[model samples]
Target: MRSNVLGSAADFRRGGHSSRRPLDSHLAQLFMRDLRADAPPQLPIFRSRLQGELLARLLLGPDREHTMLDLAVMLRTDLGSVVREVDRLARAGLLTLRRTAAGRLASRDTATPLHEPLAQLVMHTFGPKAVVAEEFGALPGAAEIHLFGAWAERYSGVAGEPPGDVEVLVVGAVDPGAAFDAAQESAARLGLPVHPVVRTVGEWRDDTDPFLRQIRACSLVRAR
Candidate 1:
């Protein structure tokens, strides 16, 4: 399995369980597809470039309201650095400062305007049907469950104006074989590879699962 796709050599490697595609996901081999051109341009918010990406990711959803200490650990920086970044975000008008006992840390107050561009890219290039099929629409019980990760990241990442396209790894229910088939077909139809690893609630065990373990090591993109 590939490890910490954003931080490790895995991003450069040709193939892996996470990176590989079945015939159905895109319907054909992903063949030399370099989509950087199709991806969005970097934002000015990331310009001050003080690990603001982490701040952006944290703000993507209401769920990941991390403390200053949490941001400290995630950035592999000191509390002071995290605090500084929070201040930067506040000054940029992207965040509002909220105080608990933890000094001045910024609170996410609004939806990012940056999200739609990436979603639009996915929807435009791949088409909404494929985005929904390869993403939310086709997944069985996705509405019933949390239905996140690789798919949710489309909104979360772009919505957060993350450093890159949303890369998701979600948990949901499906007839394992059929779901996989749909994912394959959807990807083929979209002309790009969309990867997903679905496990049932009962089947989704501890971090020992290869994917989760890699994720634990470096889902730098996962808000927290």
Candidate 2:
């Protein structure tokens, strides 16, 4: 029965809804495949970037229900993809889904055996953005926060080794001391070093500094 549900979920991904192929069948092979084992090590544990982002958002923080629209908008992906992935996860027992007046809601299934370990894995990899956002988002006078360096590069799809630490750039009137405290908290939460460098908005906009110029040349993932 479980296999049938999983197969039907796969069929949904294939633009069909009626097929009930076996779980191991070509069309019904694992919803989130281990295909990324050979891919460049950017969030390499997951089969696709969407998968990583979706799981990270749902698993890395407080367990709460989210509508499909919420996940799609947060991840900046299409609704169809989010719905499909949510359905796949729900069928796999990693997520639970139910209908409400607002729409279908999904949340991580804490009872699943994979929940704890998978959340831990996500916390170390795709978890940085969520952690940083939550920690630094409320900083008074802070205008912009972005993730840069190897982690940002990897998150932006630049192939490289997994990042050892997270580098953050804060641009605004934020106090350096407060930013440092936030970084420390984020690092503690993620089990990885988080370095947040503060710069005045004017300095960030200045094109004369070689360091700022270098940063502009690379990928920057907004934390807030």
What would the TM-scores of all predictions be? 0.34, 0.48
Model 1, span 1-224: residue lDDT tens: 01121222344453554655543544222211211113223333232323433444445323235677766664455565566556555655556667777664555655667444433443333332324343445566652222244334443333443322233344556665655565565443332344555665554557568766665454223211
Q: After superposition, how far is residue 7 of candidate 2 from its true place, in Å?
A: 20
Q: Compose the digit string of candidate 2's lDDT tens values, residues 1-224.
A: 13444465576778674464445554234334432123325555465666676777787544578899888777776676688778777877888998999999998888989997787677556688777887899889889999999878866767665577889999999999999999988776554678888999999999999998888899988987
CA displacement after TM-score superposition, residue 3 of candidate 1 (Å): 35
lDDT of each: 0.44, 0.75
- Model 2 reaches what TM-score against the true structure? 0.48
Task: Give the range of the ten consecutive residues with the poorest summed lDDT in model 2.
Answer: 31-40
The deviation in Å at residue 209 for candidate 2 is: 0.9
Query: Going through the candidates in order, what is the number of backbone clashes in each?
Result: 14, 0
lDDT of 1 at 197: 54
